[model samples]
Target: MTKKVLVIEDSMTSTKVLQKVIQKAGYTAVCASSLYQAKHLFDQSMPEEFLCAIVDFHLPDAPNGESIDFTIEAYIPTIVVTGREDEQTRSIIINKNIVDYFTKGNSQFYEYLSRLLGRLERNQQIGILVVEDSRAERNATVALLQRHNFITYAASNVADGLAQIGQQNNIKLVITDDDLPDMSGIKMVESLRQQHSKEDLAVIGIAYQGRPGLSASFIKSGANDYLTRPYCHEEFFCRVIQNVEYIENIDAIRRAANTDYLTGLPNRRYFFNRVNAILQSPPAHISLALLDIDYFKKINDSYGHDAGDAVLKGLAELLADICRDYQLARFGGEEFCIFMPLALSEACQQIETLRCRVEKLRIRFEKQILNCTISIGITDIYEGSIDDMLQYADKLLYQAKQQGRNQWISSDTKHRS
Candidate 1:
């Protein structure tokens, strides 16, 4: 369901702008011009339908941020936008349990607001671990993170922190204090580095204000960033977001490297890496098959290359849907591969079903409805190397093409019509 963001502002111009920004961030905007209207609208709808509320710090009806209080009391995360740009105003807004506050000064404010909205939506899926020995400080940190919609885990010592990190795979960032019961924060960072790289997991160390060289030690021990004891709300959230974004950016780059650009499927390199990992502890019965479109080039020659690409994309979607349980990839051009950890008979049945589905698939390009079929070569040989298995499958594939264009050939069975 599309989550809604309640916009409570008095100015018509600001309300329109906020509505556009919220919609651009992939959310619905529910607008209210005053505190009373906001209450009425909110009462008409369920509170769970709202992701958060963006309220004006000063409204005509409620001039002292009463709407902000109202939203917070209703258990909705609130973001304050005010025209006041004084230090006193900032202190008052930040003291409340709000997501963040913004000054209506320039275009940059709205830009940052857009980014913050996106971050709030993404934070729902991310987990963070806080390691601090003090119960009060730990609880305080967890509460702050919860306000931003993050899944939070707390540990009172290094041993518990390490255990939680091992158990929780979604934890992307770890914030640890300098003093812990089991070990020092620097030592904990070192231990964590042994198993996870800086790109895979981000660590932030916290030290007192007068701790000389402690920040340096944390960085040297593989912490991505560090924080001081008297950190404010803004500084703490800034450091946490920066470290988390570092890990996320690296993940995006790695995914782009492993994914095919055209069909959004795994490329040949990623397929080999995945199958090789599974091959380490080889399955009792494994089968590999290579599939090729029967007359892919003819489509390009008759219709155009665009039509050929449409057919390839259509087939890739079918392969993804049907072979979701197995390892599959597009091995360049018209060739695709599937590795199934099943017996030869079972693999044959699955591949034959896929073949029939492809035969019936009609891809529409411009005004033409094009139909295509696939030829498959399968083998269940337990070869030591993947290269050898692929070579065997390729030979069978060639034989299938020679005998007939739309048929399958297997090493242990006769060619089927």
Candidate 2:
């Protein structure tokens, strides 16, 4: 689906440039030349239709940031652009909850605006925690974050802040004040570091001016960065966004390391690591399956590696869907593994279902449809280690391939027909 951006600039030149930037970023732009037009366009569009809004602070019809007010009121993430950059104007725009006001000082500033919009677009997927004892500061910080499309969790004290962080699975950044009612923010940051690593979570400590050594203490206590109170809006966003993006980049690297590039499935190393962990703390019952494409090499020889890749990708999709409730991974090449917490019979049924699906899948490549089949072997986790379970499953898989290819063999086949 194409994302839509709202542009409310009275100047045609700026409007055209901004719209081009938005479209270049693969988004559609809803252009409005005045405050009245912006409201009319917004009224016509759905509440969730606009990804975000770029509003001019001084619209012809509403010169005093009325357009900004309307966008914020409608809960649209907004970035304000204005010709003025005085402290009074900045303060007013900051208090109005604009993501970050931009000055039309130079062409480079607009380029920065485009990048900021891109960051704000991604901010929707990130969650941030604001920890401040003062109600006003907490609210203000949350407002700013929300304006940039961040999901925010607010805490008035250190304990609640930690609890909130623990509860959220996607929160990667935390902004906390140095003075908490119960404990020092430095101590809180130190405590959090014990549970969360810098790669997983980034913290920023906010201290008031004239507080000597506060920034130093916060950093020593494991904060990724520090900010002073009464900070500029631009500085605050820069620090927060940089830290969040750094953590996200680390996460992306980790995912690339653990994922299979061709099929986007977990790689052999990740699959084995998870299985080892499960073995360390055994569950009620664990089932392991090893699957290999029957005559996969023949496909590569007959059609070419490109077609073979298509078959692999198609089979990966089917297996992922079939084993949606279980742990499935592309171990390597035409091989896949499934770790299911199910009874022996149930696991066998699921594996057989997967085999049938593979048999029926017709993958299309360059105007030709190709057919494929997979043979699977299953074993139940009993008193053996993960390696033992894998070796047993692999043995059964060999049995299936030998018993004429495209079938499944379970370790406990004596009971079932």
Residues 37-79 of candidate 2: C-alpha lDDT, one tens digit per residue: 8888888889788888899888879888899989888988888
Candidate 2, poorest ten consecutive residues by summed lDDT: 408-417
Q: Mind giving the per-residue lDDT tens digits that candidate 1 earns over 192-221?
A: 999999999999999788887999999999
**Per-residue lDDT of 307 in model 2:** 95
Question: What are the models' TM-scores?
Answer: 0.93, 0.90
Give me the displacement of residue 233 in model 2, in angstroms.
1.6
Clashes of 2: 0
Runs of candidate 1 with Cα error greater than 4 angstroms are 301-307, 362-371, 415-417
> Which residue pairs in candidate 2 collide?
none
Q: Would you list the C-alpha lDDT of every candidate in the order shown?
A: 0.92, 0.87
Estimate the lDDT of model 1: 0.92
> Which one is best on TM-score?
1
